[model samples]
Target chain A: MTDVQTQPAISTAQPEDFFQLLKPRVMSLVVFTAATGLVVAPGSINPLVAAIAVLCIAVGAGAAGALNMALEGETDALMRRTRGRPVAAGRVKKNDAMAFGVILSLFSVMLLGMNANWLAAGLLAMTIVYYAGFYTLLLKRRTPQNIVIGGAAGAFPPVIGWAAATGQAPWQAWLLFAIIFLWTPPHSWALALYSAGDYAKAGIPMMPVAKGAKSTRLQILLYTLVFVPVAIAPAFVGLGGLIYLVVSVAGGLGFLGLALRLYRSRAGDEPDKAEAVGREAALYDVRAQAKPARDLFAFSILYLMALFSALLVEALSGLGA
Target chain B: MRLTPEELRARKRRNVWIAAALVAFIVLVFGTTVLRLQQNQASERALLEAATGTTAQ
Candidate 1:
């Protein structure tokens, strides 16, 4: 609505452009968390069935990514960070990407139903719809809390994995879901704090764009505080082991420490790696200042990885499950 | 059909995605089929064992 959606086509479409539309990086995270859910479940699954389940999850995630890119083509064209995406860059046609998404979505869900259980297929189907329909089309452009509510879409992977393994999703699976759901706010807020202008320009109402940085930072701290306790709960509830307890508590504290640092370090003009160009609309030299936002953003990745890895290790060792 | 260079390029791109998707589909479906057959065979073996008062040695 801000401007005309269509832009002049630039380059011809290429194979790599189609591949890029899948957002493989995000797909890998989905695959990992979903696989962990399968592995850590109580009963053993046949390896072949397990592989099929994981692959279906990966395909479903990639399908959703394609659909997201197809919808966001216009805004993606406007943002410098997303300007080079397949549809936005004019490398692939919108119809082709959309067809690719719809086909993959159906294929993955059907395969999961055939290979795994109908429960898993249903969960995967809902996840695809939640992400591509509710989050991308409805929530993203409309509200600042879009990521907060939409975070459930990403959180569903572990639950789907659990369902695939046991044909049921109990409360423990939801605990894992809660960890990722809570982690999303701080993780995305860090990116949003650094890229506030990009969101503003794209007409997306992200938290940092609607609320000031100070408010967003404080909220990030609040979420981390809540996340750390919930993250440590699995061990106390007998779902995880000592290793998970240590990892969760340590990683949670590290995250909290970083959040506190970000709150206090209100220095002027630092070259954040996240901005790449500048901080707060001003492009400055490389030797500008320290950037806590970028630091927290990087550490959040490690935090989740460590938390999940601990549970996986303990489960594999027969100490957690 | 005769086509422009841009049209040909677009077609090629779409083909690549389709080919990749086909490969993935085959792999996933093949695995599922094999696993389902394996499970069926295992259950049949267990039923045979139960009927014969013997187990696989």
Candidate 2:
């Protein structure tokens, strides 16, 4: 999968391109969840310290993203969806991206250790290693169950945030981690369902490419069924309140409903679930199969955002008091 | 190391930002530590005064 990309010699890379390398959209979610973890935990943090913690999480997330892009430049170039990424497109040199990620990772971890507690900094370091070293390097290329395990990396942000506030991760913080962990299979598999061709072309073992779209759809529905309860568990665990309860129950129903729709989208001409065909839009007939996956992908983002927003608002309002 | 003017200016700005952030964090941590120590001392003084019927001052 090694492609010799002709990088720009002088590297006229702009600040914006470097910013884009961070995968800002993903980092926003990381920052939001981490801030929610900090706020909802049962202690007070200095606002400055909280801000520094969130900034560290954001940078760590970005560092992971850049490193992922740098390492996957070859595969990314082969996939249409990611072909234009800075490292893949040679807008930024691969070595430069690697250096940028390593430096940011160091700065973020050290800053967090100094400003917050070492527990928070240690978790941040683990997140970087889990994502950049484990998930991107080993898991993503090896298994159809890649996201199921790799989801732990994304799920750690809330725990890190809680540790930042209280210097300890109680069971409640891990419940929040479970919410995101279970949420990942469905969210990513939906994207994988539609982008199966990209993965197949790049020789990645994404679920839809390895296990077929039919099984992927079924798994999406199953994971969402499991996701709803965990997403709502915070309310009973004291991490959430009336507002969070309302949002979780309502938002969860929407998520489950969409998953069921995606599962049932495979109508009378459904392909055999056992056929080990490499994924292609044409093979599955995207005109019939793609919409539900796309809808679920979009809705998943909204569901997480709304759930976390309610938690943030409740925490800020002193719900525990 | 020899560097061009524009590159040198940008490097200077980035370094300045990093330094300022570090300094601010150090001040916050230091101030909080001092405040915690002072509060502990005051509480101890109050306890002693209550026991002895005499303020430390």
Candidate 3:
């Protein structure tokens, strides 16, 4: 008789499953922001090399995402928002995802170093380690301030892009970094306030789950107050121009209004709509009580995109040059 | 010693993808090397021109 225990398991994973492990949606945002930094930095690079730099940054971000999913598969299974992820859904094995992440990480960092400067490559490597090792393994389960700290991983791509272009990370690059770093708390907490149920189910210490929704709302308002001025600061500092000034001011006001509305509302005071209904909830299909939080969450993404797009336009047109 | 048809198909497709990814990586490396060489040569030429002009002065 054949010994079944000695045989290697056959994999049914398709390429789509592997792609899903990269978190394509998040990668798109990374690519956009990194591209903006490359375009706006005060230096010129060969177009092909610039494209390669952005590609490496995107792949590096994706690699970190793959590693995050591989490590958090079981935990992800318990959360509705993340349950459909490839590793969590069993479409991709955890070990396979881990290997994929490591391979991509190595290739991206090495290629980026050869194409750009080592400073950019080193930043990409640090971002991977920060997200996959420090944030995923250590901070996520231990603190309610997890996203606040872990958000640095998301904020590094622009700096890497700037360094790729100039081989130096000056205050201008860090100003861009600060905008994302501060924007993260409000954006994340707004989503967390609406999805507190899923976070609770997964035993994650999201602000809404750990500190209650009232505190979360207050903190979101406070953060919005701080984040907007910084978002507008780029204009005064000569890093941004008229178009950016308009976008940041208008979008920042709208963001503030939404935060205020969300703060005054009773959103997140109850379990999430999915929990209440005992079923999966569409990301945008929240209950009337939760709509304010949802509005802030949705608007936050639009506002950030507009702000970055304005900067990109100004730079490309030589208005900010 | 038997494998299901679905398993065989998936394995074949995966192998194809792996080959594609490897080819893409090789092309990227080769392109990057060529670009770097061109950049270095251009900068070296510029430096030589500057030195020759200074010597003439």
Candidate 4:
């Protein structure tokens, strides 16, 4: 009798594994910010159309995320935080992920153009291209200011939402864009301060890895100073109400305080605590010296969420300025 | 080649999800068509009314 060799079964990727390529956590933020813009825009939109527009924006963002993961799979495999991603982990093939992303991107842009306006669809298309092609393929590994320029990709959703609602992107929408654009550097660099080792290992020149922790901290402080005024600008410009004003001012102050503390501390002066301790699970649990960066990173998320939530509530309650 | 039981199960699951996605897309396109037609009709009606008012004046 001839010995029989069993061949490995073809790709066993589950639906959940494909869903993981979408980067659901990041998609949630995109959905929230986009919805807020749609709600806060001056004109009324058909409710169903608005919902579809938000869905399109979210899916478009997710498609960009999938493309990013597909292209960065090798780099992601080198980082502890991203190693579990579908493409990086080999649960989903790179070609499959790329096909999925491209299909979703096309469908989302087409549906948005039909359901809303071509302008909104065009912005969504640009966002996907900017993130996946420009940011991921060109900027990410080439420069430390990657997040600064690439931040425009994340910032476009709110403007797209505004355009979807009013068929025009006004100054207020651009202000919303500016808020996210400024917020990205500080938020990203804070996380980078504690994860510099993973970034360096992945050959990505993140701010902390390229500029040193000291300079990154100072830059964060300077960005926070500039970002807070813009965060508070919505209130003054009649886009935000009293509730938004209070939230933005208070959260801005807290953001500034955390950035100042992070600036004074030696967070990224040494190797990442998790790397030093040889424990990938200890990502959030930084050493005493790195607590400031971790704290700033955590608080920055809360501050941004609070500012947006306040705007959302004010608009929903008919209390918007 | 004979397929393994696990491969068969995975293929079946994927087929079901693909069917669901296709159905959802069909419904979205149908609804969008209906909404767009209604919007266009409303705008046309308004334009006609405005023309009639101008003629009377």
Candidate 5:
């Protein structure tokens, strides 16, 4: 038998490449959610403390993304969607990335503990571990429900921000958490439906790859249905107001309608046709599936941002009142 | 593509330095802020106590 090599050859690291591993887009979302949490809480946190808390959350988010890049680099290289990532592209070495992530993690946690409450800092630390260690390293490679369960990492920012302000987590903080938890599946599955081949090529068992397209679309619709009611629940809890209620209800209805349309469209038969003219009306069911899924993904982000922004406006107005 | 052992070690050294510098800067900024917050809290407490004492007298 020919000699079998188990390990692939590694490449050199670059200084600038380390920053690229941070997944800044994801970090920005985390920061925004965390800031909203801080602003909307009942009591006032010192401006300095609030600023520091947001900074800590952002750095912690970046650190987690960096560690994820390092651990998933090999798998990332195989997928077209992730092939251009810093670690995947060989611009950063795994060890260097790991070290960078660890250092940032430590600094962020320690600073948060000192500047804000230890409760908030501890939650931030746990969020990092949940994402980098539990989700990225373990859950991602093992199951189709990875994003569903792993979505907790993203959900924690608002809760952490609430804790940073109040020194304790409350039902309102958890309400925000539940919203993100429910939103993640449909949001991620929509993208997965469009990029199933990328996940399959990478040997990742995403929902679309493990199940059929019809099943994925059904799941997206089911989750969206479940998510809409929860999205509107904050109004009952007094965390939201008239503007939030109107925006969330309208946004939720739009989301459900789009998801329903996606479910009705069948793209499993002709993948190529789906990729090409999916946005246009077509006889082949592929276009029907692809377009609505893309629409849902784009709307989900806007939906969450708008809902939270409305809540922030209500909170600020309440403060003035 | 491959890198020589010397090149790898050099890269490693640079990364460590960069990480250390970032950590130091974050700590300094946050530590000063925490100190100021503590000072403000203490002064507020003192002022409240003085006001209560004056009212009682």
Candidate 6:
């Protein structure tokens, strides 16, 4: 067997090395969701405070990611997808990464409490724990349902942002939370479908690895089915306008179509076919994973940005009237 | 893949440095937030007092 073992070494750390620890990709999603919460809330938060809250959320997310990297450095080195990460590549020491993570975590929570509200700070703290402790340390290694459960960590930002604005979690905050929660499984499993072998090689039990590819595809379809209504639910609740309803429904249907295609492709059957599906799925995952979680991943970012942009527009229009 | 003693010691030292740096960074962030929060609270209080036209506690 090829040695999956990593050497212990601390090479000269590059600026990019530290940046990667923050998981910029994940930070973008967190920032957007948190900003959405601040924008769509009933009351106006000082722009300065809103900005601070967003920064804290971003920093807190980065800290959690750094800790995850520290904890999973060994496994990451074994996985093709994460082998190049600074910690996994032995460019950064695991302990250093952990220390950085812990310090940032404390700072983020304290700052959020002082600037925004204790409730926001508490939620941010829970998000760090959920991602770094519950998801990374435990769920990821333990089960195929990892992303499903771990997705909660990502979903909490909107709620935290809402609390920052309103100082309480409202049903509206939860509706936004629900949209992301349901979106997580399909969003991640698509990537997992492509990275199944990588995950399996690393001994990580992702859905495709534990269950068959067929089961993973089915779950993607199932979650996408539930995701559609949730995505558009804001319209009925008055959080969105007619424009939002139309866009959300159209986008939801488009997402469902993609999920359906993914299901029908049964593209996971042939190893050769896997690459084709991976390419197709990668198109979506890359875009969505970016900021919005929409052009498979790019469009995903746009999809969400547009959704919240609509809400902001509605708020502005209401104020004008 | 086992780490030699020297490598382990180096790792420990690096971790300590990183920890110190992170602590300093966090402290700066916290201080900035507290300052901002105090300013906001003061402004809000002033606004409320002006609107009421009284020395509201």
User: Could you estimate the TM-score for every candidate?
Assistant: 0.87, 0.83, 0.96, 0.96, 0.84, 0.80
Candidate 4 docking: what grade? medium
Candidate 1 Cα deviation (angstroms), residue A282: 15
Q: Which segments of candidate 1 are over 4 A away from where they belong? A: A1-11, A267-290, B1-17, B44-57
Q: Kindly give the stretch of ten consecutive residues in candidate 1 chain B with the minimal lDDT sum.
A: B1-10
Error of 2 at A158 (Å): 0.7
Descending-DockQ candidate ranking: 3, 4, 1, 5, 6, 2
lDDT of 6 by residue, A56-126 (tens): 99999999999999999999987656888989988887997898799889988988888889999999999
Q: Write the per-residue lDDT of candidate 5 for residues A1-321, one digit (tens) a residue.
A: 233343334444555566677788888889888988888888888787888889889999999999999998999887656778888887787887898899889988988887788999999999999999999988987999999999999999999999999999998899999999999999999878877777777888899999878899999989998999999998877788888899899999999998898888764433544334423223223355477777788889999898888887878778211
For every candidate, what share of the true interface contacts is present?
Answer: 0.57, 0.00, 0.79, 0.50, 0.18, 0.18
* Model 4: CA > 4 A from native: A1-7, B54-57
The CA lDDT at A146 in model 1 is: 93
Query: What are the per-residue Cα lDDT tens digits for candidate 2 across A1-321?
Result: 234243222455656667888999999999999999999898687786788789889999999999999899999988766888999887788998999899889888987887678999999999999999999999998999999999999999999999999989989899989999999999999878777767787999998889888888899988998899999988887888888899999999999999999998862123333222533233334445567887888899999999889999988987641
Model 3 residue A19 lDDT score? 88
Q: Is candidate 2 or 6 superior in TM-score?
A: 2
lDDT-best of 2 and 5: 2
Instruction: Estimate every model's Cα lDDT from 0 to 1.
Output: 0.83, 0.84, 0.92, 0.92, 0.83, 0.79
Shift in Å, residue A141, candidate 4 = 0.6
Q: Can you give the lDDT of residue B49 in candidate 2?
A: 97
TM-score for candidate 5, please give it: 0.84
Alpha carbon RMSD to native, model 4: 2.5
Worst 10 residues of 4 chain A by lDDT: A1-10
